[model samples]
Target chain A: MSSSSNGNGTPILELSDVHTYYGSIHALKGISIEVHDGEIVTLLGANGAGKSTTLRSINGLNRPRQGKISFQGRDITTVAAHEIVKRGIAQSPEGRRLFPRMSVIENLEMGAFQRSDRSEIRGDMDRVFELFPRLHERRNQKAGTMSGGEQQMCAIGRALMARPKLLLLDEPSLGLAPIFVERIFDIIKQINDQGTSILLVEQNALMALDAADRGYVLETGRIVLADKAAALKTNEQVRKTYLGET
Target chain B: MAADASVPTLANRLQRPSVVGLLGVVVVGGAAALLLKNLTVAPSRFFEVTLIGLTTGCVYALVALGYTLVYGILELINFAHGDVFMLGGMFTITYSTHFFGLHHGQGPATILIVFATLVLAMLSCGLINATIEFIAYRPLRGAPRLAPLITAIGVSFIIQDIGLAWKGPNYITAPDVFPHSRVFSFHGVDYGWNKLIVVVITIPVLLGLLWLVQQTRQGKAMRATAQDKDAAAIMGINVNRTISFTFLIAGALAGAAGLCYSLYVTTVRFDQGFQLGLIAFTAAVLGGIGNLPGAVLGAVLIGLIQTWNEGLPWHMPGSDWTQSIVFSILILILVFRPEGLLGERTPEGG
Candidate 1:
């Protein structure tokens, strides 16, 4: 909620000259970006534009082969995926990877796997319930049985159970109805406003630009443009190329 | 790991409930007739064989549970589980008599010595099971199914070799430590304290395992990890650790079975693991792989069948045909009802 005291505006997450590979194929090529504290930053791209790979690298699922990824002024480029989550970064991964056979309450409990505080964990469960009451209503139902929107809510709620300082959401609007997309975007903004820094990757450029404070455009493993959200919204190339405007 | 069994054709048609319903009636009727005949012809012998079969069946059920637990999570039929059980039995003999200085007629002190041996054997076997998972199976987690499945067989032989080396390829006698006195007599048939002890050990282990899976946090993680490893990882659950923990628990169960078998059966051999392990695996599949209670039920059924085949006086097949009979049951179960007696028939596993 407050600006940096140093006045230099140090980012909470910084990636400098990062490169990642899937075996021999280079997936991320020297991608560099900074996410400042208390701001919703988004990555906009088309298919195979390395947007998901970028998030994966930041979360330590795909380790960078070169350069560094620092989170809160510490190099975490090669940290294990589970350890990264423990260090205060939680991801609602692509496709809303909810544990299908597990109950809604059980899925949320899994999010707080590394945490041991009984009272605080219970309190966060209450907060998640407050944010998504549908989940609370269906707490005992298996997650796979829920509708798509409800499953997405459970996925996000599962992440929030970790009480992370930074949340990385990948394509939260994918495969959702228009109404649900709007609701998901609202939840994203609400989560950010509650003191968590967010870095989102989305293909829905119009919605992402509207919600994000700053947006980065990636094309085939490279960032083609980095601009403030308002500027990116009105840019001629972005409007034509991504927004389906001729 | 579910195979695409989409094309149902004729085989699936034969499995339709309408047809199976008729088959069920005939089978039930025949079984009822057999039971009535056995009861009327030799009532005392019938009671004795049934009691013996149940005791043997419960012990086998313990081993079947180990197989089911690992398969439930990993979908890998750990051929090595049987060897682990064998080694666990070996450890019981070595730890109790050699390490703990246990002897015959030690009075009430026998309980403390037996408890100490059981714990030591369980702890060692649990570590061995975890180590096997870590070293042999963890690396092949993402490989094609056949690779890990073959690896399991190879690991099985390796563990068997270790057992062979330790016990020197012979039938080693388990010390006759269980009290020989009968608990009760029924129609001149005595049920001994030794059989009671096996039940005493097995029931608690099964209960403890059920509580662990149904109630504990770790058990929840295991279910999640089994359902989806990648999703579990994203949720910050250490997928590898959960898997290893599963092996540890399965190993402990095998240890209990080892102790039970050696005491109740009165013998342990280096090669006993494979023969008995096969029976337990059959039991797991009969109950339905990945289902816990199904495994015990399957084991009990198999045990009863084996004892009846060998122990029946009228028209009884000798002990030599026991293997053939058990294998026949396995094939019949696999063909007629592959999902097993207790296994839920999921659409994807068609």
Candidate 2:
């Protein structure tokens, strides 16, 4: 695996030699990565490849058994998950775990749970609405009743409400139709363009690499390959297994 | 599908203002007439019954808050909350009697002592309940729903057995801390100062809790955690801590209510918690399990119903059947309006 820095500057989020466990089962094995500011970084893997474990570890949903996770120059390896949010890291977890009981607008408001300033929260909400007009239209509807694409919009919108410096998105296109998947990726790029760095995890390596600036291929619980997304897309090994190329 | 589609329409009709208004008029008018007729037989007896009902109802509401708060976060019935309430009363009694040596007619000093003692007792109970959750409930959180439920029941029984072993099957009298002074009179009605004291203390605490939940940062965290634990955690909420806080608040409320009940009723036993817990649970279910204001409304309504039921002249059910009637109503409400009077239908799969 390649071990070169982005060369832009110091990373926004740096995980060094991270190890994670779920009860007795080891989930992450010495994972290390650095996500620089304003870059789209994708972690590509099959099921049980520890992609979700990595994302969860960053947010403190699953604490790393061994390693240091630094965000924005602060050591946050042992910080509580909610405190992590207060430090400007927000995650849209797998399955779009929105508050099914809350309306779309309420879900968005919850995204600003740590935010103290109402005006800024409202402004961010408006920006989210602008990004996903469908959410704006169904703002009062319960999130559970929406279509999968619409729920994905709500999930992303909720994450944006945190005004996060780095947004961790786990499986944003997990269950969406192909058209919605494209739309979601386009929106992710737009979010990154607007200056929010993204750490995206996806099973669909092709779309992930297409949108990501750099890519890391995770096998089992280790990073097996790392390269620029364009080069990885054309790599012989990546194509044979992940791209289904002959 | 057709039946499901029409159910909301039917529910909408039942909840309409016109229907409620008509029902209110009939029930209130009939009750007033019945009470008036009964006034000729024994006014003092009627007054005593009314007082008893009011006192019991107030206590029920206090205990109900505990159930509602716990249900709001965990969505699990904390069967042991009532026992915790009972423990609070017992603790208050022990402390006030042994430590302070408090007695009746000591006026404001005794009241203050009892109040402070009760607050401490409540705080301890809250901590204990939180511990119970951490030990027994947290690990089982993602397991099947029934698993936690059965554990809760087991915890309830364990707490009860502990209380029984500690205190024995004895009905202990609370120290007469507050003086038996009639505070005021209104138009031939002598209002006992004790009733005023309970109401005065309880109203402010309830209002304070209501405000805390509705307006604070911690409040938002609680609501978010309740909505979705995983999402809440991702948003940086410490789901475990929030849940513990919920249990703490609920336990404390129950403990305070227990203190109030012991002082007003003048007697408390380990077993009292079971009956009171049932009534509070009924109130929570009546008001809609997870809704806060609904619990308060349900408590007040249940209180008034119990008071009015006992005070009515003709067709008045005796005190023995009060619980039976209350439970029957609870079952009927569940069958008819399961979401409760004020609970909205929560959406699935956020």
Candidate 3:
């Protein structure tokens, strides 16, 4: 995962043999992944496979007990969670963790909390509205009252409000309807195409493969397979396990 | 077809009224009837009592806001908050009389000294509160809920002891500096400058607090932190600092309320904070603990209830029954609508 010859110069985010723990129980064991600039990297895994833990480690919510995580070529392994977001990496965390009582507009405002540019923040908010018009329509509505798919949009929109160079999304399509799942993947690709690198974690293997530039298969706190997205889609092992094939 | 048509009517008749709603209507209607009866009997006395209630309620509202602010963020009851208020009163007395030689009939000088004392008391209490959070509660962040609950009680006792030592277990009195001149007179009912001054000072502080919580960027952070601490942290908000700031604001509020209580009443004691703090805490719960405006409403209502029970010339239970009635209402609110008046009802027990 850390070969470092992607021709995109230095990778925007690089994790080297990171190991994280939850109390005494080991959650992530020697996991390594990378998202280069302008690329969509997907982490494909089943439940309890340490996918969310990997994102937490990168976001500094769960500091890795061992190993190094560098973002834009600076080490962030020991940085505080809030400071991590300030360093230009924002996550639409697992569970979409929107402030339930807050209105959609306020929730989005929280995403851009670290940014100081007032006019640019307004412009970015408008841009997010363009990406998800449903949010603009329900800007005054409480985030908790929205449908699951709408909340997912609000969560991603909130992260975009931070104007991050790297966006970490954990299970954005989880529990969404099939149509919504498709729309979410489309937006993920659209977001990547617009120049922010993405690291996506998902269970919908086929759609993740379709949208991602690269993919990694994780199993029980370990990355079992890593390759180009197109290659992983056709890989026999990934097909039998994560792809739900015979 | 007849049965089907009747079903809609039956459903409409049933509506949303539960036993509790019916009970609420009966209680409110009964209270209104009693109030009307008293008003007709002695309008001047009724108005006088109501004005006193409003003034006292303003002070309670300030303290209640402090409880609600801390509770909203950490879900801790902060039993020590009331004692912090007692400290505020002591600070006010020491700063006003000893430092400024403030006395009655100073006129314009009284206002300046009072304002200076208010600022000093607020600043001292705010720092004390923030320090308490840093030393006492922050370390127990990862501990169970009961751990902090007991710690709050322990902290309350420690503060009470400090107050006891500082004032030597005696009632401390402040200089009665506010003018006794009438602010208004109507139908033989007189509202004094002393009372009007309390309300005037309270309105601006209340408005300032509302603006700070609702409009400022820091206020948004406080709200976000309150609803979800982890989510707030992920949003790049310093959760620890926000909690500390919340304590600071809550303490400052307690300080302001302390000044009002001592100056208006002209007498204070070491043990008064415990009793008044419980009343304010009850008010917070009655109005919905985390909701700011609800705290104010609850405090005012309690104030009115206390005054009317004592002052009104009617078939009332009188002053001796005041505590019983307030606590009874608290019990009723807990049993029927634990969310308080304005609190949103949340699903309990998962």
Q: TM-score per candidate, in order?
A: 0.92, 0.79, 0.94
Report how far off residue A160 is in candidate 1 (Å).
0.5
Candidate 3 per-residue C-alpha lDDT over B218-289 given as tens digits, one digit per residue, 9 for 90 to 100: 999999898888789989999999999999999999999989988999988888888899999999999988
Residue B212 lDDT, candidate 2, scale 0-100: 81
RMSD (Cα, Å) of candidate 2? Answer: 5.7
Candidate 3 runs further than 4 Å off: A1-8, B1-23, B347-350
Task: Give per-residue CA lDDT, model 1, range B73-142, as digits (tens).
Answer: 8888888899889988999999988988877788888889888888888888899999999999999987
lDDT for B36 (candidate 2):
76
Question: In terms of DockQ, which candidate is stronger, 1 or 3?
Answer: 3
C-alpha lDDT values of all predictions: 0.85, 0.82, 0.89
lDDT of 2 by residue, B2-72 (tens): 01334454356567677556865786698577777666576766666666566667778888989888887
Q: Backbone clashes in each candidate structure, one number apiece? A: 0, 2, 0
* Shift of residue B116 alpha carbon in model 1, Å: 1.1
| Candidate order, DockQ descending | 3, 1, 2
Provide DockQ values for all models, in the order shown: 0.44, 0.39, 0.50
Q: What is the DockQ score of candidate 1, to 2 decimals?
A: 0.44
User: Which has the better TM-score: candidate 1, or candidate 3?
Assistant: 3
List interface RMSDs for the candidates, in order.
3.3, 5.2, 10.4
Please give, for residues A83-135, the per-residue lDDT of candidate 1 as tens digits.
Answer: 88888999898988887767899889989988889779988999999999989
